[model samples]
Target chain A: MTSISIIGTGKMGSAIAEVAARAGADIQIIRRRAGAGSSLERGDAEYGLVGDQLTGELVVLAVPYEAYPSVLGHYRDRLDGKIVIDISNPIDFTTYDELLVPADSSTAVELSQALPAGARVVKAFNVNLGDTLSTGTNGTTTTTVLFAGDDPAAKIAVADLIEAAGLRAVDAGPLSRARELEAMGFLQIVLAAIGKTRYESGFALLQ
Target chain B: MTSISIIGTGKMGSAIAEVAARAGADIQIIRRRAGAGSSLERGDAEYGLVGDQLTGELVVLAVPYEAYPSVLGHYRDRLDGKIVIDISNPIDFTTYDELLVPADSSTAVELSQALPAGARVVKAFNVNLGDTLSTGTNGTTTTTVLFAGDDPAAKIAVADLIEAAGLRAVDAGPLSRARELEAMGFLQIVLAAIGKTRYESGFALLQ
Candidate 1:
């Protein structure tokens, strides 16, 4: 059984949690800021505050790109040795006109640099919209999660988590390839914003 | 009936020619340098050398980004009042590490500026691999062509050609959206180069 710790309570985080639940993994939700007092029992998933010690071998950073510095700072040395899943599309949200990361790099690469040396960064879920993941399908096409990482073992583990949820998982080369994935995400966002496409529709890897 | 004159008879040009054939459109294949004397006939499609006068209402630039200068110069005024379809990826093939175009503009935008004032430039087919377009299928999923352009009539003309070929055509907003589409093409190409994906597989937009 896999143990997963996800930080963030937004739509993306909630969407990923559904996958962990379906996998029967031990789910831990670490909020960036504790929500108002409705913290009663919500299924078998555990809840923790931002600075709380991470309890899962796999830590998913489901928050926005803007929250990375603060969240990564909170974890600091604690993230070492844990597989960190960075699912962020580091676009400047105010205008959404451009990506905030270096033109040559991606949010996943940036997260890898900021994390503790031993932490492995697996890039996934950034290419997907929350509604598609939650619905588990883009109409007839099943949601496929494209993940990339430098560590083979870490990639296998992340793929297992995603596959256990009955969704497809594609290996999109190495972590550096996240640059392309972020661009795909950016395109999806802008298309939806301009009403060219829908949040329910996204870039699907089809064989 | 719609008529399409394609500049460049490489794999990309051949693929678009197939689309026009299916659309029942009159097709013209223009070779950069006249091919060896093997030119007998290719169905109803006509063949021409570079400097030959273009006869179709729609001129498809199926050549690579590298040949743009010479090809464009050859057909400079000939492209006037034509719907010019640019399907080039603008990738630096020497090292597939980067897209040759600027951060803010796409090959379509550049072609628009370079062509005569009445020419309409539409960006399409660059996101697809030659294999996928040629085969008309990526295993189970059918090919979906995403096109962007400033001209509504041009986009519709290109979409009709694609749909007539039994593939889906998606309108990806205005010409500026070509930047995102080019990024999508870059990712697909690099992924294929690294063995992460296949030339027979590509980015499919699911409902």
Candidate 2:
């Protein structure tokens, strides 16, 4: 079984842990404190290794966009030679539809810049609702999850996790597509505001 | 029957025709040219007011965003005392995900300003897909269409047309919500590009 390490035990982080654990994968969770056994609770680790702390080939960053830089600083060393899946959207709640990041850059790009040498960053699960991720099924009719990364193997690894979670993994080319993906996320929220669509559920492309 | 005039007959315009006409409404379509009940063929009238002949309490601007200014200019005098629905989104196709209008201004806002005195402008039907309008049903489930306008009576009339076309109509409060609605349209395209969702459907609030 492929081993996985999940950072952040919040709503999305915990949900990813639960689903990944249930899918028959060996999962390790890193919290604020240190622990000896599996499934360490929050506030368990103090001054952890960037990449060496977790014994998994894949690491999932489930922190908020604002916390991304600090999270990377704490785990950059451990991240080298591992696939890092980014599921954060840098949204500016203050301005509603206006993006908080610069026009020429994206959060994924920012995270990539924060990574240590040889670290692979891939963006996925940014468009999906956290509630749906924890409760939905991956049976006959699976919802599509998009993944974009510079490394083909890294994308494949994340795609496997998405499929194992019972969803369809669609490769949306490279990391630049993350801009479009984040913009789509903003659009989804706007539609939800007007009661046109919901976060618990979303569109499935027919074409 | 409520008499309605559709100012453009393109794919979306034709889809609007299908919706309004199917509702048993007296529909008059002003194609590119001017004549006695002319077909939506090609180049009919010179930009504005197509022969200065139009008779309807309600007029739908079914043209492109680039043609919005000209369409508004032509109908300025004729649109007086009538309800005008602007179903256009000023999206910059060249930049893909960037907004064409300035940060403070929007396409609908511009149209509202260009209207003649006493004419009421409503922004609606800009988020729904043409195929969705044509199909009327999303995977065996009926969907909802949202609308926003400054005039209460005009919104009610538009809502009636939406219901007549076989979908639920949601009044998203005021015309200022148009910014949010237009952003939703942009998001739909982004989600569609990455295969995360279909643009042919909308969200319905349970509450």
Candidate 3:
């Protein structure tokens, strides 16, 4: 079984953890403090601390965009040589009309630059909502999970995980394409908040 | 019948004209010069000049983003009190990696600021590819036409035309929301170019 470590026990983190566990991955949950109850407890997953030694081949940063800097700073050394998957959408909450990152950059790109030299950063799962990710489908079609990373092997690994979890994986070129992926996420979130498609909607590319 | 004037004889202009013509709208094709051949002539549409007096209730600007300054400058008076639909995605083709407009602004919003005071600018059809707009469907699902504008009446008029053309019109809140719509357009265009999804694809919000 594939080993996966997920940080943060928020809605997105818990949802992704559930999906990974159901996919039969060896799941590990890392929390800020020990004994903190998590939704992962119901599954056969182990718990660890933020400062614990990393064991999983892939580590998912499921925290918000703002918390990335602090979280990476806390575990920078341990994350070396690990494939890091960024699922944060850096949306501006105050205005809710714009993204917090610069136009040319994305949360994934910025996180990649800040991480240790050996870590590989891949962007995935940002486009799907928590509820949608848990279900892996939006009624009729499978939820499309678009991912971007510089490493081909790393992308394939992420894509395999997505497929095993019952979702479709679309490789959106190199890591530079993360800007567009985050933009798509921002638009989807805004549309949902305004009651256009509600939060239950997912994007399907009809050919 | 709803009268519609399409400026510029490009692929988008001609495709929209075909859709409007099929929908039983009284269509007029406005070129830079009179008697200039247009694909729209293949349909039951009249040809006119850019300097000609504007008679249509709705004028669709299907020109490139770079041509908007020159075209809008020449016909500023004629476009007054007319509903202008911006279908240009101000993408930075030089890089094909980012949008040319400022992070806080969009092509539609910028065009609205430069237009005559009474002219209403609604961002529509920018998210749909020209071929997709012409067909109004991508294999299984009806193509969604997402429109955003400050004036409720103007948005409804555009939405009605979209529905009449056999597409689904999604109201994405006010004019400020055009930023997100354009971002969506930019992402879709880039995805098509990279072979992630062919240009034949259309966005479907699966509930």
Model 3 CA lDDT for position B188: 80
Compare the candidates by lDDT and give the number of the best one. Answer: 1
- Runs off by more than 4 Å, candidate 1: A36-41, A92-97, A135-142, A192-201, B36-41, B92-96, B103-105, B113-118, B131-142, B164-166, B192-198
How high is the TM-score of chain A in model 2?
Answer: 0.83
List chain B TM-scores, each candidate. Answer: 0.94, 0.85, 0.94
After the best TM-score superposition of candidate 3, give how far the Cα of residue B119 lies from its true spot, in angstroms.
Answer: 2.2
lDDT (tens digit, per residue) of candidate 1 on A1-207: 799998888778888888888888999988766663243335788999999999999999987788888887789689999999999988888976788988778889988998778999999998898887877886567788988899999999999998888888888778987877887888888767776557887777664
Give per-residue lDDT, candidate 3, residue A44: 78
Better of 2 and 3 by DockQ: 3
lDDT of 3 by residue, A1-207 (tens): 588998888888888887787678888888867766444575478888887876788899988888887787788877888999999999999988778898778888888888887999999988888887788776467777889999998999899888888888888778987877887788788778877665666566554
Give the 10-residue window scoring lowest on summed lDDT in candidate 1 chain A: A33-42
- DockQ for the candidate 1 complex? 0.50
Tens-digit lDDT track of model 3 for B76-156: 777889999999899989988677788778898998999888999999988888887888776567778888999888998
Best by TM-score: 3
* DockQ of every predicted complex: 0.50, 0.17, 0.59
User: What value does the lDDT take at residue A92 in candidate 2?
Assistant: 79
Order of quality (DockQ):
3, 1, 2
**lDDT, ranked from best to worst:** 1, 3, 2
Error of 2 at A95 (Å): 7.3
